[model samples]
Target: MKLTDLDYARQLDREDPLRDFRQRFHIPTNAAGEPVLYLCGNSLGLQPRGVTDALQAELEKWARLGVDGHFAEPNPWYSYHEIFNEPMASVVGARPEEVVVMNSLTTNLHLLMVSFYRPTPQRYKILIEGGAFPSDLYAVQSQARVHGFEPDDAIVELFPRQGEKTLRQEDIEAAIAREGDALALVLFGGVNYYTGQLFDMGAITEAGHRVGALVGFDLAHAAGNVPLKLHQWGPDFAAWCSYKYLNSGPGGVAGVFVHERHLGRADIPRFEGWWGTDPSTRFEMGPRFQPQAGAGAWQLSNAPVLPMAALKASLELFCEAGMQALHQKSARLTGYLHELVTSIGAGAFEVITPAEPEARGCQLSILASGDGELLHQRLMEADVICDYRRPNVIRVAPTPLYNTFEEVWRFWKILEESVS
Candidate 1:
């Protein structure tokens, strides 16, 4: 049977090992109470069914124990963030000591930059993708300014060659080499948010170190969406938000990774806070700053228990599903979507995201030939939920956790009709 046949899609879903995982999420519905065809996990994932219970448990603890909840039994509020260490480390491929759940994505980026993006008068440049997410660009520009360097001069952006939709690996490596001694920090998105291009992070990290620069990643679009080996890749730092592919609630607590080599070092200049102090010395209220041993040393405030509770729920799901199995299913899901979209023909849309699975995650950015927003509106009206970027791109991610082949087939039907 052809891929376009509805039964064929259904058959694939029936055979999928991860199909049962779909019921674990709270699928959003339409006016008729039918589940919407959701293909936007790259932006915001569906809420896990367990989130309600996870949050209520914390709320009850707050009410029952009040101030004592901080040290109370059964997931004490004080050390709540510590629970994420092993699970989150497994998601991003790092040691527990190297990972910490902390401030929001951009906030963690700025904090990590304080210790990693140290710029000298001679080597003060920062390199990033040309169309990086706005928040990352803003943070890097502001950092350049604070260090007494002009943003235009200090910031170097890598763009794809003319007519190309994504940057070539060689071009990225060459750019890092060209910067040579002048490069201070090489920060790039683990996956580009707009084009859905996954950069060669390991190669990028190696090149940055060769030039005597620190390297880091803004993994907002990557953490739970892709299989990452942060410890093996060995970037100086990395940060990611939990709300997207992780299926945590909106504005959820973010995560950070600091290479173990950088932890427990006194020479590194970090923005100190009470929470970053050693737990033994923390209650002592000492005047001196005695830093924590690992990534927790970057924390400026105590754990946000409410948001962390939500994150804990999602991370538990990830641990249960296993990243390896999730990734395998993601490739098949996105691959099927790609095949369906390509069949719609070049007259309607062109996929800007890389064709290779290794070079991307679950997202496929369709460069529409006509009004992209109008197409987006049509999809919304049909109860097909996806996101449209400015200009001509419509990004759809067939996430493995909840989305299925049948949904991909239905989305193509709607997209084909809308384009015609």
Candidate 2:
């Protein structure tokens, strides 16, 4: 629909099923105390109002129960991580046994690598996207170094064809076929952090497995933003940070998924710790390490109770408003944003993200012809909180939970003024 069609936009908002959810979050305001059009959920989600109370409960537990809080509290701090499993699994389309909440994103990536990326001399290379996040690049490079392989030789980066902004599935498949025999693992972000392109995970996994390579994903930007089927896709492993689309706070705990098929594989070596030992026998202080079955075996230490509490609160909200419903709203909202940006014409800005709705999440990455940061600064000064990436990209994500159609229209109006 044409973005200038204000009546139609209002009708869309009125018909929006998830519209009521906006009230649940605390939208930030300018010094004048008016609600800011917050389109930065792709970076950091606005905090849900209930999160403070949930966190306070954990604080009260700590204050009242002392050291005994681990086992004696209302939601026992010892098994606090378990509270997140089912809802988290449901969010990602995985079984409860396949998922576990643990440390931060990069840390989980390293731990999953310890078990999944066992590189032999003959098959020592890893495949990743060309412009992967810096943390992912560092982790992959370090993993290669530990395996006695040069990063230059062991890391294969897939790039887009000349003049294209995103990688094609056929190209990704061809690369996997050509290098599959020598590749130990295939790991890519589920959605490109910069370009906002959603990779075909199931197809990618099939192609990688055909050549005997383990497949995994960093779903940091994709987890709650896009629909996922990690278990059905047959990926060997996956990891994600909850801070972005999950609406857990910054530096929030992350989640990992290990397909149940691998649960019984004792040969799969891990960086083991006592927290991963069988819960019933964990207190025995035994010499042997009997890792818990399923993804729980990946746990390195007891979970942080406060973070878990906050996560629990957010996931409960997601559970009440199912991901399917949110995804429906996301598709339309992002489509509307895309339409508005295009209506502004190509000379002012170009969308770097995929054009097809199926190819991306809610994020519409606009590349300004010149002075992108200047335009971004102007938008911020106008109390519109979208984020700017280096060189030229400004990413605006209309989060389904809290953003409205009117806010999206207001963002573009401000953009039009900035560019004019």
Candidate 3:
């Protein structure tokens, strides 16, 4: 169906299995009190309706039980994190033992690097994408400095060829092969935050392993938005935040994945804490540290029950909707947005996100030739919410879970009016 046809959009919405899911979120309205056509799920997702009750239940538990809340039935604070195992594992395509919901995104990256990015004199360099999220860049640079190597000398950054916006898997593979034994780790975003380009993670993981390097991904934009097979892809470690595509509220708890092979390895170095100690003998106050099995061993402190309760609520929705179903709807939603926007702004804007559906998730990055922020403000004033970058790019995300086809059509009309 043609993207410009309102009936086509309405028809798709009517037929959509997940259409009712949008009503479950509290979408923000504009200054005039109209519901803003929000397309910023890539930054922060809308809050779910069940979040208030979930948080209140934990508050009541804390008030009534005091410290004894740790042992409460149904959702004991002591074992609350365990409930996420099955659902989270299913989302990332990993074994239950391999996944654990824990600290924030960058914090988990730093923690995982403690164990995985072990650099020897011969294998001391780290390879990464050129324009990674600033947090990952800072984390890796500081890691190199902490290990007594100069950041410039120990880091290898791969950039796109002269005139391209996205990366080629071949270029990444070539860099991994060329680095050989000097490479200690390969870290890239599963989806680039700014460009919204998804990488070939399986191929990158293979290339890193071929050169005896550990591989990991920052899946802030990719996880929950796209289907992942972290265990099958065989990356050594990975981390992501739940605030974006996961609909878990602002600064929601993040998660981690450790390959089962690394679960019980004593030789791997890590920054340990009391919570990560073996649960069987945890309260015994044993002198020696006995790390728990699986990714739970990486925990440094007790779980944050309030935020985790909020996460649990959103995850219940994802588990019900299923990632495969979400992804299929996401492709259709994003493709329609792409077609309509391109047709309307043909000579003025170019799509920088990859055209291939497999190489992207729900976002589309449009590179405009004029005042980016002014255009963004125009959209904002019109209640068509989106975000733009420093130079000349605006990013729009039509999230499958909460966004509608009619919203995408409205955004196209607003862009036409704003640029005209």
Candidate 4:
């Protein structure tokens, strides 16, 4: 059967092992009460049906136990964040002690930077990808400025070769070597937001370490979307938001992974807080701060029970489905989307994302010709919920958890019509 045939797409869906997982989420409906073609999991994931019950459980605990909920039965509020350590570690492929669910994405980045980005007068530059997500760029810029250096001088942005859509691994390695001993930190996004490029994080980490620089990644697009081995890759630190591929709600609790090598190191400077103190001694009311042994020490405040509850619901689904399985399904699903988009004739649009299945996750960033915004509006009117960047990029993620192959096929038809 032709790949463009609707029957072929439906057959793929029928044979999908992950097909049953789609029903776990609450898909949004159009005016006529049909589910919209939701391809925006790269921006915000569909709500898991389990989220309501999870939130209600916490609310009920608060109502019944009040402050005593801190130590109450089932999942206690005091140690709420502890439950995520192992599960989140599993998602990112790290040791349980190295992972902790904490503050928002950029907030976690800043906190981890406080410990990792120790800029000396000689080695003061932070290397990042060009056209990084605005939040990451801002965070690194501010970190450099805080250390008394101009942003332009202290930050080195890596761009692809002339006329290239995505960066090559060789180029990234060459850039790191060029920076050499002068580089203080190598901070990058695990997946480029604009191009949907999944960087070779393990290689990047290795290269940075060879140059005596600490490396880290903002896994906003990578987490849950791709299978990561953070421990084996051995980046100094990493952080990610649960809201996107993790399918946690908006403004959901974010997470951090501090390499076990950095755990309990007294030399590392971090902004300390009461909750970060040894939990056994946290209630001692002592002035001298004795930090917890692992990533938990980075916490500044007690867990936000409600937000964590919402995340916990989503994490359960991730845990059940498993990252390896999800990633395999993601590659196939996104590969289908890529095939459909590219088959729409070369002049209509360009797929800026890497073609290799291993080089990306679920997203395929289409650089539409002419008015991309008009095409985006047309997609919205057709009840397709993908996202558009300012210039010409349309990011469509056929998330493995809830999105369907049929939707991808229908989206291609709509995109072809809109472009013409």
Candidate 5:
């Protein structure tokens, strides 16, 4: 019997060590009162059941103490962001001092660029993937314009070859070498949002340094979904949003990773605010700014306590389950989805994500052969929730945290019926 049968899916779910984790999240229900087959964690993860308690505790604190809650026990509002240092560091594979949970993804990206994208006449170009998320593209373009250089001339975008959807690692290394000393910085999405392809961050960082350029990554789609060793990879900096596979609520607090080598260096320029000041002299109202050591120095404002509360709930879950177990099950779960899609036995669509395990994460971007928009609408109507890009792709994410093997099988049925 084929493994795509319903019995096989049930067996897989029964044997899955992380099976109970699905109960921890509040899965959405359809009109008929059954839980929907939700595979949209790539866009926004399902809310954890603990989120309500987390937020409520903070709301009570604010009501009771008003302005004094910043010093309260269990979780002080003043040092709210500090609580995340160890857990966030573990999630991204960094030292506790190297990571900081702060502003949203794009905002953090712009802030990091201000300090790291130091363009000189000799090395003024920024290197990026051609099909990166639109927000990153806009940020990089504006950075060049702000530095008094034309966007077209100062930005180098590496694209795939003819009839190719995903970029090869060799091509990326070649581009970094071709740009050579002219490249000032290399900034890439650790996983391509459209194709769901995972770039070799280690190789990319090495190539950038070989050419005397700084390297960084926008891990919006990579973190929590894939195993990362940011400090070991030795990228100059990195940033990510928590809303997706991290299972944080919508618009949750984001985080950053700064290499230890840049610590205590006043040479790199950055935008400063009171929150980043040394805590010892922070309230002194001193004239000169003495920034905190490590990634804490990049913080620009007071912690947004409410959002951090929700993010904290999810990070707690991550620390407990551990990335090792999550990553191991993720590969198997995603592979099963890939198998089922290929056996659909009709040329209705194609999976554009790389086939190799190391070359992609949890998502599989399906390029519909025709009527892709209509197909997406029909899937939604059937209570199968995934996401669709503008033209052709339908991105389905089988998250290891809350998604199940049986759910993936159910989705395959829904997709097959809808397309047929």
Candidate 6:
């Protein structure tokens, strides 16, 4: 495991079970015409090789069949969304009936909140993580305001204990206990976008439910990077976008999960549309709205075929590789990145992400002690592509599907020279 061991790195790559997956993606090359070391999958995953053909087929269908393409084409636009159900369900650890592919991430978050965040006068408080993504904070705050409550009074943010970089299970449990009586909902990210901390979803859900609060998760950072069990964990709802680790292209169709227990609750309120109505009775033009049985009940419109087509292409690759195999490779690749970065001696840089493998996905956030941005710029100049968060924190993710162990080593070698 020595940092200088090139043979060791190559050996690891040779033994990688998912090594063949790298060829399936189109890695970007630098201006000098060399393939840049890509470690930014946590932001936007590299495109799959099959996406071009998947999209081309749709365009061909449009040209040939015109309006009749809805039911005449091979994949058939009328039922194209249905083709994604099984693969998506397997990815998120849910039954087919409990998941749906739909609108963008924030839109789905708003729709889920409309149903799950039913704050009563006595139980009107919401709990969220302190360093959540800004969009999530805004959405939750807006939901509280529309219900005639002050954001500060109704939303409780749980932060890490003093001197700690991440939230602890005991601290989270204590907060739920203190606010459980008044807490109507508990919503948090499955993985912290900044620090790359993967929260304990099952335990948190249990703690929230103990106090009669509904639990939900924003799985943007965790969806394809980690193994999840949304159905078994019994979260009331969860949402994620497909652009990042899912590699479906930017602004692709997102996904949502709802537990089967909520399917029969006709009284649960939601913002519905024609697509969510019962299919058989939908075209009848009935005055009364009867929602579909499961997660489809949350849909707001007809499926957008282009984004869904790209998503389907990426998902087929995921289905072939399998999540468990991908995660197994991911753990070692990220661990190697962590070890190399930390071995570069103190006063040069520090890693803010958790050391425990179980507590993170693929990302590793490093806080350079001085001139962090300068070091990041140097890495970019060397054609090692990783993202830098403002002020501090350089985020590098060795995604199992496309990144190689040698790429991880080279990124750190560049960092060592830049700091020196």
Quote model 4's TM-score.
0.99
TM-score of 6: 0.98
Q: Which residue pairs clash in candidate 6?
A: none
Model 5 has an lDDT value of 0.93
Which lDDT values do the candidates have, in the order given?
0.94, 0.92, 0.92, 0.93, 0.93, 0.90
Candidate 5 Cα outliers beyond 4 Å, as residue runs: none
lDDT of 4 by residue, 96-160 (tens): 99999999999999999999999999999999999999999999999999999999999999999
Give the per-residue lDDT of model 5 (tens digit) for 171-225: 9999999999999999999999999999999999999999999999999999899
The reply for model 3, stretches above 4 Å from the true place, is: none
Candidate 1: clashing pairs of residues: none
Looking at model 3, which ten-residue stretch has the lowest summed lDDT? 341-350
Better of 3 and 6 by TM-score: 3
Per-prediction TM-score to the true structure, in the order listed = 0.99, 0.98, 0.98, 0.99, 0.99, 0.98
- Model 1 Cα shift for residue 56 (angstroms): 0.7
Alpha-carbon runs more than 4 Å astray in model 1 = none
Stronger candidate by lDDT (5 vs 6): 5
- Ordered by lDDT, highest first, the candidates read 1, 4, 5, 3, 2, 6
Q: What would the per-residue lDDT of candidate 3 be over residues 132-217, giving only the tens digit for each residue?
A: 88898999999999999999999998889999988889999999999999999999999999899999999999999999999999
Residue 240, model 2: lDDT of 97
Q: Judged by lDDT relative to the true structure, which candidate is superior, 2 or 6?
A: 2
